[model samples]
Target: MNEQLVLRVLGMDCAACEQRLAYAVRRVEGVRYAVADHGTGVLEVHLMPGTDREAVAARVVEAGFTVTGVETR
Candidate 1:
């Protein structure tokens, strides 16, 4: 039941931004892994079953970035 969450994030300007966001997202309770790519403005996350998507988005926002879109599969 694991889910893959694809997020479009804004305001990331460099590799440091990607690393910072990946760290923040991976700390969320249900996240298995997170990879942020500033070049494409995308954050890909693997989450445990039943993880709340809103909660994940909140964590990203808290990390000082904007989550412009979210796709779950």
Candidate 2:
């Protein structure tokens, strides 16, 4: 099974921040796909089954973005 996660991000000031976050998420194992939008401060990620959402979020934070909220679908 696959799961989708969307995170509402904060403190992203420009496109570069968006790019960095996207890259970090993509680096996680089992991350099938990912996209980060600076305008919306949202990141949509598709993951394989059992993917750790918090770990993914941590990577985002480590990349220098604050995760304000998260939704899994």
Q: Which candidate comes out best when scored by TM-score?
A: 1
Question: Candidate 2's residue-wise lDDT over 1-73, tens digit each?
Answer: 8899999999777888878888889999999999998899999999999988888999988887789999999
In terms of TM-score, how similar is model 1 to the real structure?
Answer: 0.95
TM-score of each: 0.95, 0.92
Q: In model 2, which regions exceed 4 Å deviation?
A: none
- Show model 1 residue runs off by greater than 4 Å: none
lDDT (tens digit, per residue) of candidate 1 on 1-73: 7899999999999999999999999988999999999999999999999888888899999999999998987
How does each model score on lDDT?
A: 0.94, 0.91
Clash pairs, candidate 2, are: none
**Inter-residue clash pairs, candidate 1:** none
RMSD of 2: 0.9
